[model samples]
Target: MDGDCKTAVVTGGTGEIGFAIAHKLLCNKGKKVVLIGNDTKKGSEVVDSLNCSFGRSKATFYKCDITNREEVEGTMKKAKNDLDEIDIVVNAAGVWNDVCWPNEMETNLGGTINVVLSARNHIKKGNGVVINLTGLSALEPFPNSPLFASFGAGVIHFTRSFGHDVNFRRFGVRVVALCLGITKTNLHVDLDKKMLTKEMGKGMSDFLKNACYQKPDACACAVAELVKYGPPGSVWVVEGSRLFYYDVPDYKECLNLVSQFM
Candidate 1:
């Protein structure tokens, strides 16, 4: 990725998907990565592994609560000072908790906002890119996971708007929303037993059984490719191992029609 990008920050870099993305950036793209996550132990483990693979200083870990704006800012500053410039920022930190409504929403949506806003301030000019991970739930709601769907949908809309923002466009940073297909991740490990045993988890369980889950490593590669070449403000979907760009129509005509009534 010479002249394209150099340094990247992957939020939730301790998670499976995030880790894979970090690895792709470090090993494949040959870019330095600063990982942000709340888990010190897992974060340390991932950092150590990446460093071992790509030599020391290739990866650094920061334990941060993305929902906290101050912490996000501090982490971003430290990363910039440590890595010089941030060319890519991937908001992969998310939650699928049905039990904790507030925390889930805060993590998935609020945390994403914190990262995107802080990242825009630090990203390099003209070639910086921000990739926000959304999911199928965002495009189509699941009856059982209303909160999760809402969070995903919120992120998609926010990302699209950020991509369309005039000032943001001036920065020349590409913003993309990635609709990752169902993948095996730790998010499901502690799912409420009661919910799983009852109707709530049925939909999810069926979805998991039927959904064509992509491997984290493979999806990581696709994400790297998207970061390298995807158009700004576009949404890309990955399902059943298929990766493709999603078209968003120009809504000017609809807006014009509505403005007459207003």
Candidate 2:
């Protein structure tokens, strides 16, 4: 690894979007990456593929379950020890099952909290970045999968709060949220089964019939760009292969609207 190369830790690295992000970082941005996931076999295979394409030591895989704080902290420590320092941490591991909403919440929101807290310690101050992957559902109501949307909204709020200017000045870490829209991944498969009810599932299935889907590579590209230029507390949306910044109004700004009604 080159001393000047940036090192990143990507959770859920074996998945489509996560793998694409890792690939973009290594191949396009010339960065070293540590992939974290629970599937030992898939993790090793992804690392192998990345290493073969990039370099022998450009990529590494650590078997970790992000929902476990202890495991996440331990893995971050090991990754820091191996890489010397972590520059970027991408919280990409999430679940969308409404039937098992508790587990989904634990993995999506709890896992993100664990990784962000652990990474903050390992990441070098004054030059660290954390990208939390939310979903488009966070921006709007998803009647089909309310729990999934709720989890995304929670993550967005957390990212915004943690990435505020006050926290950034204190910790020197920039946190940003990326809201991805209907991407072509396994996440879309069996969408009905993942919903809160069969009726909602059917509705969701019908809703997506004409929806446009972007490839994972498009999202990966947006992530790479954000890693380089996104400001702390910023939110971005990627849909139909296009990326755009989203301005989240402050409490005062929202209160102004209520005052008009009064």
Query: Highest TM-score: which candidate?
Result: 2
| After superposition, candidate 1 runs with Cα above 4 Å error | 1-5, 190-197, 250-262
Model 1: which residue pairs collide? none
Give all candidates' CA lDDT scores.
0.83, 0.89
Compute the lDDT for candidate 1. Answer: 0.83
**Cα shift from native, residue 10, model 1 (Å):** 0.3
> Every model's Cα RMSD, please?
3.0, 2.5
Clash list (residue pairs), candidate 2 = none
lDDT of 1 by residue, 150-203 (tens): 889999999888886575567788888998888778776645442423677776
* Global CA lDDT computed for model 2: 0.89
